[model samples]
Target chain A: MLKDFFRTFSSMIELEFRRLKHDRTEIYSRAVQPILWLAVYGPIMGSIRAIPTGNIPYTDFITPGVLIQSTTFISIFYGLTIVWERESGILKKLLVTPAPRYATVIGRAMASGIRAIFQTFIIILVALIIGVKFILNPFYFVLALVIIFFSSGGFAAISILVASFMKTRERFMGIGQALTMPLFFASNALYPVTMMPKALQYFATINPMSYVVDAVRSLIISGDLTNLWLDIVAIAIFNIIMFTLASVNFKKIIE
Target chain B: MEKAVDVRDVVKIFNKNFRALDGVSLEIESGSIFALLGPNGAGKTTLMRILTTQIGPSSGHAYVFGLDTVKEGSQVRKLISYVPQEMSVWTDISGYENLLIYSKIYGIPKEERNNIINGVLESMGLHDVSNRLVKTYSGGMIRRLEIACALLVRPKILFLDEPTIGLDPSARKVVWEKLKMFKKDYGTTIFFNTHYMDEAEIYSDLIAIINRGKIVTIGTSEELKHSVGGEILHFILSENGLHEDVLRELEGIEGIKDVVVSNSDVTFVVNDAEMILPHIMTFFNKKNIFVRRVSITKPTLDDVFLKYAGTRIDVSGRLSEVTHVRRMIRRG
Candidate 1:
C-alpha cells in the first residue's frame, strides 16, 4: 500500500516536471514579479526607514518575505490548474486509478511546492545580483528550501480545498484573488509584525506565511536558529491541517 | 461467471430535486459491447459514472466483476477503465508522454512500459504521431490517444460515455473500428452511451434506450427494431398540397400503427406496407392529392426509439443542446 502511494506521488511530480519542461515560460514569467519587488519596491521601501527592520537593510529584510510572496501567489492559484483538469476531464481519469485519494492530494500539493522551489532559485540569484548579502551557510540554506517547499505545499492544499467547493474557474479565481492579498498583507511580509496594531499582530502571528518569512529570513539572512524550531513546528502543523482538509474534500469536486 | 457489470436499483439525485438516474438496473454480459442509448438529460452519463465507481449510486448497488463499486472501488478501478464524455488528454504533452503517465499510474513494470505503450500506440494508429504534442493533433487523433490511455492495462471492462459525439462520420467509424479490434483481441466488455441511432444499431450486441432517467426499452438492435414491429411507409406530398389534413386522415386508416407528419412529408408505420400502398394510392388519387415520392423501409433504431420514448433520438436541433449540457457539466 505504501509503495503504491509513493509511486502515485512520484508520478504526479514527474508529470508536473514534464509539463514545466514543455513550457518554461511560466517559470520565467513568475520571476518577473519578484524582480520588480526586489529592484523597485525593495529600494524605495529601504530608503523610507519607517518600517524599523533593525540593523539589516529593509531590502534585505524583505527578501525572504518577497520569496515567500512569489511562492504564495503561485501556490494559491495552483487550484486553477485543478479546475482546468476537472474541466478537461483529466481529473476524472486520474481519480479512476487505483491510487489512494490522499496520494493524489499530497502528490499534486508537492508538485506545486516543487514548482515554487524553481522560483526560489531564481529569486535567490536575483537577490545576489542586487547586492543582498546572506550568511552563506549551506546547512541553513537547505533547511530554508525545505521550509519553503512544505509552506508552499500547505498553501497549495488550501487552494485545492477551495477548488473542491468552488467547482467553476471564475468563482475559484474570484475567491483566490480575494484571498491572496489578504493572506500576503496580513502576514509580516512587507513590514515588521511589531509595527502592526495588536490585533493585526495577532493575525500575523497566526498566519502561516509569517512563519515561513521568519524562518526563511532568519536562516538565510541572520543565520539565527533561535526561533527556527518554533517556526518549523508551526509550518509543519499548518501543513498537516491543510493537507488533511484538502484530501478529505478532494472528491467533492467530482460530485 | 460474474457479469461485467451489474447495476441494481441505482438512483442518483442531484441537488435534492433532479433525479438523474431513477432506479436504473441492468446487467452487461462479459465480452459483449453494450450500448446505452438516450437523449440528453436522460441519465446515461450518470449511470455510467456510477458503474465506473467515479460516483456512488444514491440508494443501491453497482458491481463490476462481482466487486461492489462503492465498497470495493479501488479493486473495481483496477479491473475497469473509463473514457469520459469530455476531452481528457493533456494537450501540452506529447502523445507518448501522456501514455507514459498512465503507464506509470497503472504500475506497469518498468522494463515493459515502453514496449506496452508503443504496442498500444501502434494498435490505435497513433505511433507516427506519438512524439508530437497532443495539441498539434486533430480531434480524431486526440480521441484515439484518450482511448489508448484507457487500454494500457488491458482492462476487463471499458466504459465510454458518448465516445463519438462531435466527430465527423469517418472519424466516428475509425473509433468504432479500433474499439471493435480491442473487443476482439482482448475479449473486453465494451459499454458506451450514444444518441447516434446507427452507431448503436451497428456496433452494439445489446442496447438499452433510456429516457428521463428510465430505461424505456432494452434489447438487441434487431430485437428492438422488431419490437417496433412494422414497415415504415413515407410519402412526400407535392408542395402545393396540405399535409396536416392528410396526416390526420392517414391516422384514421385501419392497420396504421403510427403516423408522423413533418411539413409536406408523411410517414406511417404499417404491418404490411405492400398491402397498404395500393389503398393509400387509390385514396390519394380520389382526393387529387399529388404524391411526389414514396419509399418503404424496415423499421430502424430511430423508429424503435420513437416508439418507446415518444420522440426521435436524432432531432438535429437537440444535438447542440446535448453538447451544451455536457459543457455545463464540465464547467461544474
Candidate 2:
C-alpha cells in the first residue's frame, strides 16, 4: 500500500512536469512581476527612505518578502489546474485508479512546491542582477529552500481546500483573486509589521506568509538563528494543519 | 449466467426534485457486450456512473463482481475503467505520453510501462499517430486512443458512456472493431451506451432500454424484437387521396393487429404478415386505391425502441445532427 502511494505520487509529479513543458509562458509570466518589483519598486522605495530600515538596505529587507510573494502567487493557483482537470475528465480517470486519495493531494501540493522553487530561482537571480546582495551560506540557503517549499505546500493546501468547494474553474478563479491581495498585504511581504496599524499588526502576526518571509529573510539577510526556530515551527504547524484540511476535503469531493 | 454487474432498485435524486435514476435494476452477464439505450436525459449516464463507482446511489445498491459499489469503491474501481462521453484526451500531449501517464497511474512496473504503451498503441492501430499531439488527431483516432488508455489496466469490466455518440459511420465502425477485439482477447465485459439503434442491434449481446430514469425493457436484440410480438407491414399509397380510407380498411382486416397512417403511407403489425399481406392488397384494390409500394419486414430494434419509448430511436434523424457532429469533430 505504501509503495502504491509513492508510485502514484511520483507519477502525479511527473505529469505536472510534463504539463509544465508546454506552459513555458507561465515561467516568464510569474517571474515578470517579482523581477519588476525587485529592479523597479525596490530601488525606488530604497532611495526615498519611505520605510524604517535599521541599518539594513531597504532593497535587501524587501528581497525575501518579494521572494515569498512570488512563491505564494505561483502556488495558490495550483487549484485552478485541478478544476481544469475536473473539466477535462482527467480527475475522473485518476479517481478510479488504485492510487490512494492522499497521494493525489500530496503529489499535487508537492508539484506546486516544486514549481514555486523555479520562481524562487528566478526572483533570486533577478535580485542579484539588480545589485541586491546578502550574506549567503550553502547550508542556510538549502534550509531556506525547504522553508519555501513548506510555505508553498501550505498555500497549495489552502487552494485545494477552496477548490473542493468551488469545483468550477471560473468560480475558483473568482475566489482566488479576491483572497490573493488580502493575504499578501495583510502579511509582512512588503511592509514590516511595525509600520502597520494596530489592527493590521494583529493580522500580520497570525498570517502564515509572514513566518515564511521571516525565516527566509533571517537565513539570507542576518544569517541569524534568533527567531529561525519560531518561523520554522510556525510554518511546519501551518503545513500540518492545512494539509490535513486539504486531504479531508479532497476525499470528500472525490467521494 | 455469471453476473458481472448487478444493480438493485438504484435511485439517484438531484436537487431533491429531479430523479436521475429511478429504481433502475439490471443484471449483466460476464463476458457479454451490453448496450444501454436511452434518450438525452434518460439517466443512462447516471446509472453508469454509479456502477463505475464515480457516484453513489441515493436509496439502493449496486454491485460489481458481487462487491458493493458504495462500500468497496476502491476495490471495485480497481476492476473497471470508464470512457466518458466527452473527449477525455489531453490535447496538448502526444498519444504516447497520454498512455504513459495512465500506465504510471495504474502502477505498471516502471520498466514495463513503455513496452505496454507501445503494444496497446500498435494493437489500436495508433502507432502511426502515437508521436503526434492528440490535438491533431481525428475524432476516430481520439476515440481509439481513449480505448487504448482504458486497456492499459486490462480491466475486467469496461464502462463507456456513449462510446460512439457523434462519430461518422467509418469512425463508428473502427471503434466497434477495436472494442470487439478487446472483448475477444481478454474476455472483458463491455458495457456502453449508444444513440444508434443499428449499433445496438448489430454489436451487443444484450440491450436495455431506459426511459425517464427507468429500465423499460431488457433483452437481446432478437428477444426484444420478438417480445414486441409481430412483423411490420408498410404500404405507400400513390397520391390516390384514399390513404385514410385504405388505413381504415386495413385496420379491420383479420389478423392485422394495428394500423397507423402518416403522409400517404400506411403501416400495420400482424402476427403473420404473409397471410395478412394479400388481404391488405385486396382492400386497396377494392377501394381502387393505388398502391405505390408495399413491403414487409421483420421487427427491427428501432421498432422495439418505438414500442417501449413511444418514439423512434432516431426520431430527429441523423441528418439534423450533422452540423453539431461536425463541430465536435472539429474540436478534436
- Highest lDDT scorer: 1
Give me the runs in candidate 2 sitting further than 4 Å from their true place.
Answer: A251-255, B233-294, B312-332
Quote the positional error of residue B118 for candidate 1 in Å.
0.5
iRMS per model in Å: 2.7, 2.9
Give the CAPRI rating of model 1.
acceptable
- TM-scores of the models, in the given order? 0.88, 0.87
Best by TM-score: 1
| Model 2 chain B poorest ten-residue lDDT run | B323-332
Query: Residue by residue across B1-332, what tens digits does model 2's lDDT show?
Result: 76899999999998789999999999999999999987778898899888988788999999998999999999998999998776677776789888998898788887888888998898889999998888888878988998899999899999987787667789889889988988899999999987678888999999999988999999998889877888889889886335555457666778988887777777888887788888878877787778888898898887888899897755355435643653443352
Mark the regions of model 1 whose C-alpha exceeds 4 Å error after superposition: B232-296, B314-332
User: How far out, in Å, is residue A123 in model 1?
Assistant: 1.1
